[model samples]
Target chain A: MSIHNVIQVEGLTKKFGDFTAVNAISFKVEKGEIFGFLGANGAGKTTAMKMLIGISIPSSGKATVAGFDVFTHAESIKKSIGYMSQKFALYDDLTVKENITFFGGIYGLSRKRIRQKSAVLIEELGLEKVANKLVGALPLGWKQKLSFSVSMIHDPKIVFLDEPTGGVDPITRRQFWEMIYKAANQGITVFVTTHYMDEAEYCDRVSIMVNGKIEALDTPKKLKEQFKVANMNDVFLKLARG
Target chain B: MSICVANISKSYKNVKALQDISFNVKVGELFGIIGPDGAGKTTLFRILTTLLFADNGRATVSGWDVVSDYKNIRKSVGYMPGRFSLYQDLTVEENLQFFATIFGTTIEENYDLIKDIYVQIEPFKDRRAGKLSGGMKQKLALCCALIHKPKVLFLDEPTTGVDPVSRKEFWEMLKRLQQKNITILVSTPYMDEAALCDRIALIQDGKILEIDTPEAIVKHYPKPIYNVSANNMYKLINSLNAYQYIHSVYPFGEFVHYTDKRAEFNAVELKLYLESKNLSNIRIEKTVATIEDTFMELAK
Candidate 1:
């Protein structure tokens, strides 16, 4: 892995009213690494992601995404990163090709460039035959893959996936992780948050958020060894319980 | 049988929601209906709960026919739909009272049955159901469902979208309920949760793949599998997939779960091959099967 850090945060915090959704947390993510951010629902995982993605302003802290300050260069950070939220950002009514074209247009890609990228993407995912099929008509697995590929259509420096594999069958989930691996292989830093502890095992490193504070951060193997647990799920259970 | 389903089938237009599905739950057993979305879990739940009818076959819940004895079934069974169906505008306390009154009983009459689950949410009694957190809302829903002291409870995806901590607590609540001899039939898409059930019916495309204890199902895994990982997981998986002798390759946790067609596979030889491919930090070990592994094998 490269020593270059794509993301850096120190004493980051966010508060709403009296509740601190994210406490003073500090961490750094290296370029070309898969970083897994974990927490239970309402554990500030979403809040932290929003702050890092530059959508939500942090109450206090220092952070940067892709060498751009999250506070001042939020707009530049937005342009330099791609985000795939839990609720898919695809237009279900649109055909596969149409969805790609629309997202490409949103990213300001030229018509010719969009066409080129769409062709390569369709061929890569074996969606050549269903390129014109409505996204709603495709199976859950196909739609997930299509949504992920669309997120990378712009080839940003980093990609953030929030619960990308929820509700997908085991087979489809495996296939989706393969896509994540390929993206990381191509040197795109992957920042992902998931409820599925098993997915944590695939990351180069992970940080577990509890309440509003980052309780644990390390390689998955080390975290498991430190907690003296058989798997990531037990590690999470122990942390969440505490 | 606390619940019995025999040759149940249902269809909506051209789509078959359920097909010849059958299962039984003994009194006090925690039965699980496991499947993904569109797997007909909701339809089956609706049928048993008397909210919908099956086009064919028969079912009985709590010794009452779902069709002929709908009224009795409704009285003896508590049903919690997949989605949060309680009144969003009502306060937590008000929702519980409304359910209790509709069942012709006061909360005081069955307070003991719901006390363990309800006490946690009692502090939020004034909070609107919509304003409560996902976990708190689930607890209130469960409280209202059990307010009438129903003999059987049906919870559809109770833990979906809940945090890991809340999910664990909810399952503990289910176990506590089982002590009162309340036959619980729960459904979830999460394969790990299947292990918590006494017996689970794995469903896919509206068909039952297997019905057995989680342990027995894992014991039946057809192949000896290996957990394999290397510095570059992407390359490791690709190499495994391209290997002629490999039968199946899927990502499992931090490693790739591998199966080979050969009777006797050599882990060292495979390691040497991966080494030649310039893959470092390789780790391979025999691993026991899990519900997810069994589910994938059966799904294929």
Candidate 2:
């Protein structure tokens, strides 16, 4: 594997009984690249992501995340990467400060380091006034932003975001993307999945999965040209519909 | 009017969910409530559908009071909540039959109303609702919601988390449903979908920001927008934001949508400034305002 490639996969397949959830998908993600993983609903995006994140075992495949083999070093892979999903990320009952500190501890940071990190995180996010409030009381946009920050508290080499800006307001959604750009500029690879096509355009490269396999993978401009469409949304509609 | 809401307000504990919300939907009109999550959209929908009560003000559906005449409203309107609310254990066909029976109607009685949508999911009629795919489940839910042939339909974020293709198909189905003379009121966070509605209400922070046709809303933008692009997106955004004449900078697809604080701005001067910052391959062009632009301006 190349030193710059943070994630390398070859013939990665996951099967359940008679069904193949992810079929022989292969791709490489370079360091600090924003990779967009897109597919229709029930196209095995979640399953493929699960295998890559080291939470699920691939039935038959060769994959490495952060230089750790998925089959042999699953635990190491989990520790080397950060993950946040729209459905579940942070504990709602916990306060913002507590949530940040808890995630820091989970990532095995010392108590002193956790304190320093939490202070910086609170100030950076401008959450000084609401740091003591329960996360459940915060607005949806604030919760999403806090969740992203908490996921990165460990400063992993790569972060996986699943629909991070699903229902956020227009401005907050843009703000969230700006945060992503900052992370990428700091040399952290971002593997993200989103339903919004405009957000898809923000990625450096995008791979569209259909049925259990990746049918097309390229930059937004190339994909648009290859499909003879005007935008990513049209390309997606043509591919997914077919 | 098919639906009327006057000064509706609701609160939960210390959080104000809805405040002084008012709107009216004409008969056979395809109206939309466009907002993001926790914007009091669900609260207003529940009150109008008679599933929940407002702490103040009043509402009516089909000219009947939502409180005193809830039973009539319930029978005359179809509601599909944001989440998949069908019985998971039951087959798709069985769920539809059950909903039809509860409404004191038969599938044959209202077959024409949901024929277009139901046919798409008929292949999975024997499958349990829980086992269906996301798109199939959405179709099944819509089918059940229309089995009774109500005069009005209330869909609360029906396409939330759905893919772009399915979202387009769902909107087409709604347009066809409108031809049958049913007043449709749907809510979604997608600004693009707002254009499909005859009129839309943009809501945020439990308050109605604006209510007008999507075209009119875009025209309300006070400044001319420009599509600005450079080789590096991140640096371009930062440099634009740091510019003295920058009014607003938001990243659109493949470009940054920028507006100037000055009434008469020169694009050439801005291009030269970016060039000084070591940016190359710069492009700037005037672009029309979209619903999202209007929404952000209003919300701000």
Candidate 3:
């Protein structure tokens, strides 16, 4: 059965003055599904994602995220969705627990809920010993994992992760995906943008953006066959060359 | 005797960069510190190269402690930071000469060590380092690092921005470097590159998850995999994933990789069923699990 659509975009376009960052494009994301966004560096993936997450406004086109209009309901959309950026998104001076609390507070989570969530998240992430430790002192992997958990602290219906696994090891990437699966199983939709073509293969569906246009959108397997390529990398090569 | 890290723990104030990290790189071993940007690979490389100090552990390279004998340790090791930190105004040859002078050596004396890497970019030696392409810059950087003939080399995400073909050529240079019997500690976020390393330390945050040969790690992967591909791939993946018997339906190449969801589901029946879907010309076959798959399996 086709998954119910949770994210809808009709002719989404974003123009930065004269240049079009994200051209008129359209796609939909299903509720509780893992949607991967793939593109090369400087491609419109980030632009399109920023528009969808409400950080960047679209010049034209309409979008609804989690059943809320991305234009007028930007605040409510932000409330219902979590975001993890490409750069590490935690304060280096704060302790592990403090970082979680800070993010939770921003999401307007109750102090009690923050405390409870902190306890569970810390234990689940194997960060109990580092609860009082400063986040800046933590390794890249731990910080990444913690950042991920922090993004979901408020139980947002949708989460936007931007290259959350950029320089992490294979093991950490795997663990990261597991966390994604756990969230997906819990019915939280995941929308992630990444440059790594292989990582794009992990998504239930992926859209490839090039030159502000979504040239290809499909499951990884279909992309390879459609492009007459061996892998997602080849699919991207073909799309980029075109 | 070697590069040894014991119980290293560090935090950046709000982020944990390394947690009880420990490892050893022997002479002549091409050891890879595999992880994403925040995985503490850079922090560890910095600590080992004496660029950064560890908070709660001790590490020694060539018998010089990273914290105490930092100067001595720095002198004996070559380092290529994640970002391009070389002098951009200087020409390619000038940068190499400058690095050589710092280590009390001359480029002529060590010409053989970097000949393979340097020759390709020799034509641009007079060109400023800043103007070179990503691949050429990489070559110059490697040449500069190896000029001193250091016993150990540290490269942090050296292939981040280069093209795939360039990346392959860079790795070939690394293999040649290893033949010179220098211990190499390199970090990369790409999973496919992990297989090329003789041994790797899979790091995240600040912790060491596993240290083993790449082959051994893959040998430990426990999963049965199948490949499925057809026109309109996204719909097929959704359909396959919805099936009760399909466990995982990830895209691998020109095909979607499907596994038995129920664990006991047979491959033969699954192949027939996949053909029944809108997908055609299914190439359903059992294939070897990759490092990424192994990582997922191990992480779970």
| Candidate 2 clash pair list | none
- lDDT string, candidate 1, A1-242, tens digits: 12499999999999999999999999999988999999887889999999998999999999999999989999999888988965866898999999999999988899999999999999998998999989887777788888999988988999999888777778888899999989998999999988788899999999999999999999999999999999999999999989
Q: lDDT, candidate 2, residue B108?
A: 92
Worst 10 residues of 1 chain A by lDDT: A1-10
Give all candidates' CA lDDT scores: 0.91, 0.94, 0.81
Ordered by DockQ, highest first, the candidates read 2, 1, 3
Superior candidate under lDDT, 2 versus 3? 2
lDDT of 1 by residue, B156-271 (tens): 99987676788999999999999999999999988999999999999988899999999999999999999998887899999998887898899888888999899999989999
Error of 2 at B241 (Å): 1.2
TM-score for all predictions?
A: 0.96, 0.99, 0.64
Runs off by more than 4 Å, candidate 3: A1-5, A10-20, A59-64, A67-73, A95-97, A110-142, A169-172, A195-198, A228-234, A237-242, B1-31, B35-78, B83-153, B160-185, B198-300
Regions of model 1 farther than 4 Å from truth: A1-3
Cα lDDT tens digits for candidate 3, A29-76: 998888988766566777888778877778999898887888888888
Tell me which of candidates 2 and 3 scores higher on TM-score: 2
Give the CAPRI class of candidate 1: medium
